[model samples]
Target: MNFHVTNHTLYVGKIETLGVASSSILQIGDTQCISLYSMFDTPPESVIVGPVAPLSPPEGAESAEGEDDRNGDAEPESSDV
Candidate 1:
């Protein structure tokens, strides 16, 4: 198959799909990548598959808002100068 190359990137070809989701094998440099093409810009709320691997968080969840939760909840107290 002849791949179209442009701007240091190669457009291999369009991949056919039965669902809304589609994918293609793009040759970006030396790597042959499997790129997923989705009609939705972002993912759905929750994706369920198999016995595990839920992509979304559970319901009624709070956003971290850029806060780090790695060490658990903590508060900064006023230090004596």
Candidate 2:
């Protein structure tokens, strides 16, 4: 396999999520050679699928429900005459 790319331009503003599943390949640029091999011992029935749970926020990080409280807890500034 051979690839000749010239004057290639790629602009990305935002990427929310990118997922690469098992036995997959993600190539962005030109490559001279690529070899991939995957071996699995588990049978087809061994695979388990369940609901995807939402990840909890990190410690001290505000939760989505508490976004409105961000500016509500500021103490009032006192004026000195």
| Best prediction by TM-score | 2
Instruction: Write the residue-wise lDDT of candidate 2 on 1-81 in tens digits.
Output: 998767667876865648976677776666777777788688985655777554567777654354353577644464322
lDDT of 1 by residue, 1-81 (tens): 998866654566876556542554433356654557557455673544678653466565575344465586644463322
Each model's lDDT: 0.54, 0.64
Output candidate 2 Cα RMSD: 16.6
Deviation (Å) of 23 in candidate 1:
9.7
Once fitted onto the true fold, the runs of candidate 2 whose alpha carbons sit more than 4 angstroms away are 1-4, 16-29, 44-81
Clashes of each: 0, 0
Supply the TM-score for candidate 1.
Answer: 0.15
Angstrom error of the Cα, residue 72, model 2: value is: 56
Q: What are the runs in model 1 whose C-alpha is more than 4 Å off?
A: 1-28, 41-58, 63-81
For residue 70, model 1's alpha carbon misses the true position, in angstroms, by 17
User: For every model shown, what is its TM-score relative to the native structure?
Assistant: 0.15, 0.30
